[model samples]
Target: MKILITGGAGFIGSHFAVKMLKEQHEIAIIDNLHPYYSVDRKKQHLEVIKEAGDFQFYQTNLLDRDETINIIKEISPEAIVHLAALPGVAYSILRPLEYIDYDVKATVNVLEGAGMAGVKQVIFASSSSVYGMMKNVPFREEMAAGKPISPYAASKYAAESFCHVYGHLYGMNVKILRFFTVYGPWGRPDMAIANFIKKLKNNEEITIFGQGGSRDYTYVGDIVNGMGLALKNLKQSAIINIGSGRPISMDQLLDELRVYYPDMKIRTEKNRAGDVDRTWADISLARELLDYEPEVDFSKGIAETVAWAEQHEDFL
Candidate 1:
């Protein structure tokens, strides 16, 4: 199957692209190589993808409607994986309009472009943050996501809505996957696990917010696998949570990290606004619908991530 993956140079997208390519799927990628992270890292991801074969790659922003539409028309992909977005909740707080422009508007453009091009299926990247501060222990797809605290979460929820509208209007097959905190090797440096590993390796102080908030740190490999499963079962419009369904507190994570890096140091700080205290996913729907189950546990995933960080210290 011919597949188009947006943001295919970023952390999760890059991993997914490599996995799909290894399965011998014809792949086309679109990424802007934004300054959000090291362009060198993005280039490295592209180099890895090139090893599979000379696949299609376009250095274009999703906001460019003409360019995006033209690319879709040319590729005529059987499936479209929309992973491009302005992702950081805190950053969105500082630049709400930028988040709106890239996360919300750009998503609409993808949906519209896909619809016009008669793309069969779309797998969107949503976030667990959209659940906000839910009293529920494990969040479900049916729960109200209208209480998104940050601009980033709001934009993602809006994009999910747009996907539904496109699905209903144009008979487009859409699958919305609300990803939990994904961490692993080749992870984004800005993410907590990666940043903490980097800081600890350098003997620098790592900040802990809210004295140990919790998250369901899903591994990138597991996520990409779940994405593949979701794509296979893309029969209709649906929203599914992709996670380990296990919650690990920050203190627990730090303790595990200390085991890996005995000299690791951390400083406590107040939790930032728009940040949730905890997040655990009810992945039963994902398992039932997409046959998706997380294969890597937290401890193993963190250890692998730490090993990768140690080997690639120069990149940090």
Candidate 2:
């Protein structure tokens, strides 16, 4: 399959690129390399992707509808894996307009462009944040995601809506996969895993929010595997959760860090607005549809992340 990935230079995007390439798929990526973090990190991710396999790349933005549509037409790919967006809950609170605009409007451009180009499948990179503050333990696909606590979540929900509309009106096969907390190598400094590791490595105080909370931290490799399955097996249009399905608390995560840094410093703070106490994924739908079974356990994944961070100490 020939595929176009919108944010191919980022963490999960790069991992997915390698996975798809190994599966004998040709890839073309579009990314502006927005400075949410150091562009160097994205460059490093590109280096890894290039080392893994052959692929084309475009330094462009989907917000520029003409450019995005033209590139889509030029590529004429069978699938468009839309993963690019301004992500971060706290960050979104500070810059809601910028984040929401990129998340919602840019997604509109991608969906429109894909529709115009007659793309067979559109795989959306949705988020677990859309299930904000749910009382349930494991969030299911049928659960209502209408009450998002953050602009970022709202924006993603809107993007998912656009995807559904495209599927309904244009007869495109849309696969909406709501990703949980994705972390691993090539991750950005904004993410908890990377930031905490960097802080611990530097002997800086790591801040904890509200006795801390649990999150379903899905490994990037696992997410890539599920995403690849979604790409290959989009029957019509569906929304599914691609996650680790194992929720671990922040204190528990810190305990895992203690395996490496035995005496890591930490401070507790009030929970930030729009933050959820926990996130657990009911991945039964993904398992049923995509045959997706997460391979990497949290302990192993955290250790691997620490190893990668140590390997690239200068970057952190």
Structural similarity to truth (TM-score) of each candidate = 0.98, 0.98
lDDT of 2 by residue, 49-164 (tens): 99889899999988999999999999999999999999889989999999767999999899989999999999999999999889987999878558889999988998889888
- The residue-by-residue lDDT of candidate 1 on 1-316, one tens digit each, is 8999999988999889989989989999999998888999989889878887768999999999999998999999999999998889889999999999999999998999999999999999999999988998899988955999999999999989999999887799999999999999888888899999998888899998876689999999999999999888759889999999999998899888989789877788888999989999999999999888899988899989988888888676
Alpha-carbon lDDT, every model? 0.91, 0.90
RMSD of each: 0.9, 1.0
Candidate no. 2 TM-score = 0.98
C-alpha lDDT of residue 100 in model 1: 92
Candidate 1: segments with Cα more than 4 A from true spot = none
In angstroms, give how far residue 188 of model 1 lies from its true place.
Answer: 0.9
Candidate 2 clashing pairs, residues 3+ apart or interchain: none
Stretches of candidate 2 off by over 4 Å are none
